[model samples]
Target: GHFRDNREIAEIMADVQSTLLDLREIKSNDKEIMYLSDQVQNANTLFLQCINKLNALPKPADEGTMFVGSMLDGFFGNFLGSYHRGLDAEAKQNALNVELQSAIAAVDQLEAALLLLPKVAEKYSATLSDSTGRIVVDFNESWGYSGPNDWLVLQNRGETLKDCTILVQLTGASGKVRKNVHFLETWPSNSSMWGRYQSGEEVLGRTVEKTTVTQVQELDITIYSPQFATQIQYVYQGAEKDKDIAQICKDLSFQGAYQPYESGVIWDTQRGAQITLNGVSYIPKCRVDVAFRKGEQSKGWHWNHDSWMKGETKSFNTPKGGLTFDPDRVDFEVSFPNTNYKYKSTLTVDLKSGK
Candidate 1:
């Protein structure tokens, strides 16, 4: 008797059922549930392997040998001793087969429950709620000389949403989809948040005409809040890129000569006082104003319809009285009519020591 008793098989069956119930109660939203599922699968495999090994074992007694023994017992008045022994072995084998079948059934049920774990986990992962009055999502894009800049704007209109996870999908005209996720500790009431969909590095001198190929046409956003989830979609309203003129104006430099005068240190325009924009990208036709201030006196020059291209240098000599005397700092203001965006930046240079 390879198996002395059915206690082990019975315990295995009960354990399988208990594991199934435990899986049913697992309300996990993360990889922990997946790990449990894998463990269950491995246990099921071991059960099958055990059943296979049991089935492969040799039968307790062969049928041919039992028939011969029965015939001899009938003739010799041995009272079927050998035949009875064979019958006992056959009964034990049959009982073992029954136990194996029951084990197989229990394992099958466990596997069926395993198949449903993922669906159940997904259901409990993020519960969706009506965001109609609670949240608002919008999309905006602007074209710039470099490329298109896509932005997702989320506004919380009602109570605060805690542990917010925002997912954004941007689809372009070329059938390319870009996705980005943002996390916020709390989105307060009556507050708005902006997330830019970074499409990667921008090429130099990217024009408006070239943006048609990869222009964002649609936007899908999902907000996962602690209480519930909200999903929304919007058609992208495209606009020309809003170039940060202030950022581009970082390269603007003023190289001029100044002399200490009784009134104030006067910028000596006769000694090659000039302003230059160096190694700049393509700038649209915009107005740029350069000013110098010294106390109450400020002198400035306005360049109308000024634009420069990549690797192009634009410099202009200061007028005889264009720059104020002993200027502490130079200010730059650029206005773009196309995007209606104004950027102001300042540059301070030590003129006395000329560093």
Candidate 2:
């Protein structure tokens, strides 16, 4: 029974290994890949435990004599007798069989779950048109845009998006409305075609001058894709402080620090304070809000009106009036504007100002 059980377990392991190899080839996001890999590890661990128990079973005494006696019994009336030497060995073997069965069931369930994971697109392309019915904007696999038009394109890199409804607002060089609330749709794993609106026509059927595409000053785009919705927590790994500013603040006195520079003031705009934030987003078109605070006094910069791309890093500096004193903390907040998904992180600063 032990030999047969060991052989069956070996076969099950081989099957599971093949399935894991297939899983690595599937195109999915980082989160889904991690989840599937964990399931495979759990199944492999269970198989190892079952093999260890099978090998630890006691061997039968006098195997040759026992085999001969068992053969004679099999030919006679005692064919169904126990194969092991004692009741204890029989009980242990029974328990091992139960455990082996459970391991096999786990592998089966893992394979079933693998079949249910969705196949997501690896990349996408977007094409936009101007009022002249010409393709004025083209975005390729790298999400880079090329054309004579002035526009902002926000691309979703790794996240899965389906049936996306995009709202775009275009402004001319005079900061007047060239276009507003133009709706566009994007299909799954396919390129998007936009700019179906007629020239000089607004969403409310108002008429405006047909402005030149290249004279566009600002472009705002917002996307609503229910299928691409997922909660993401943007982690604040840390902040990189400016070395020059740090050295200046080290020997400065917090009291009477308001004096002008070259007149004995320690910190000022000439010796500005700045910190570059390191962040990586898995999704695109996010809004970033950064604030630097020292007690009740705080300064903030909002990027809610702009688009923050995936895997992009943003840097912040001290307000127009540079930091006269060391900041106690800095806060970073990111969210998808017009959506409920939001994430916030705070960093406590130790400026080592020697004050």
Candidate 3:
């Protein structure tokens, strides 16, 4: 029974190894990858314990006596069994280690693709539109793999932006409206990891996202007309910080509005703004909020950076160019003149010429 039980245990361990190898052969999601990595760790521990027990057992007796003949036979059988078990455990442990390392590397690659690409784009392409009264953002996504087997993974160079927010307020205008909105959208959280993975593909194409993209080869969004608007107030979360991710917003506002208004609160002025996200811990679970007030008490407009969900809060920034820190919420307030005049209407970011 002892020998039979050991065989059964060995078979179970082999099954686990096979399962891990199968996972490595295909594209997998974050949860699946993490689960496999954990399983490998548990197997290693089990193997180590089995080796220790085998090493503690005494070797078989060379001479068998009439009185101790039966005892000697049993001891020799047990000793041989332990020796074989130890060898098997060691071999499996070695293989499991390799699989664990590969799984972890895969997880890191997926994280970069899902969470880092967008952040990198926001860092470099967070620009204010000069020709249109809109905030222009550009993002790129790509994937590749290394090792003997072509594993599906994303590039480590890029970063991601979760629940990121961008607020644009057209001050000194009447009846404001937001247009040309776009996002580097993602699939459902529970969706398959191989949703975008293609077999035998060495290099993934560069994917792009823009604020105001058009179906036509050429397109533009203009927000000013006879009124010729003025003053464009905008704000957004910057890139990852260089160090101390927990205090990522220390340099700016910890959920506070951005001061200096990237491009002076003037019409037709284009300026680029960036917030570093080098080390924020909760990048994937971040949320953003932006508020725009036309008149001091008008209750102008409130918007969410992404989809509206439960437990979401209202805008939190103060008007008149001020910033405060608060991790619990993102608050920024901007007061725009609602003169109700036709010529004083707020136009696009690049329509007017004067400073």
TM-score of each: 0.33, 0.23, 0.16
Instruction: Give lDDT tens digits, candidate 3, residues 1-355.
Output: 0112223333433533453343334334545544644645464444435444433434334232111011111100111121111123455434433433343343233222322222222332334334232223222111111111111111111233222212222111233331221111221222211101111211112221111111111122222211121123221112211122223223222222222233445642222111222212222223332432222322222323422223333233344423222122222322112111111112112212211
- TM-score: model 2 vs. ground truth: 0.23
* Residue 137 lDDT, candidate 2, scale 0-100: 32
lDDT of each: 0.50, 0.37, 0.26
Candidate 3, which ten residues in sequence have the lowest lDDT sum? Answer: 68-77
Candidate 1 lDDT score relative to the true structure? 0.50
Ranking by lDDT: 1, 2, 3
Which tens-of-lDDT digit does each residue in 188-306 have in candidate 1? Answer: 88888775433332212221112122556677777765456767876653332333344444554333333222333653433122344444456667787777676787777777765
> Which candidate number maximizes TM-score?
1
**Over the stretch 1-355, how does candidate 2's per-residue lDDT look in tens digits?**
0011112434444544554444445433456655756765676576466546645654333343121112111000111111232234556546545654554455445433433332211122132322222112321111111222222223344334543434444554466653222112333333333332223212112322222232333445444444443212211111111221222223322111111122236644422223232332233455667666777887666664254433344444445455455556767675542234455666666556421
Candidate number achieving the greatest lDDT relative to the actual structure: 1
Clashes of 3: 27
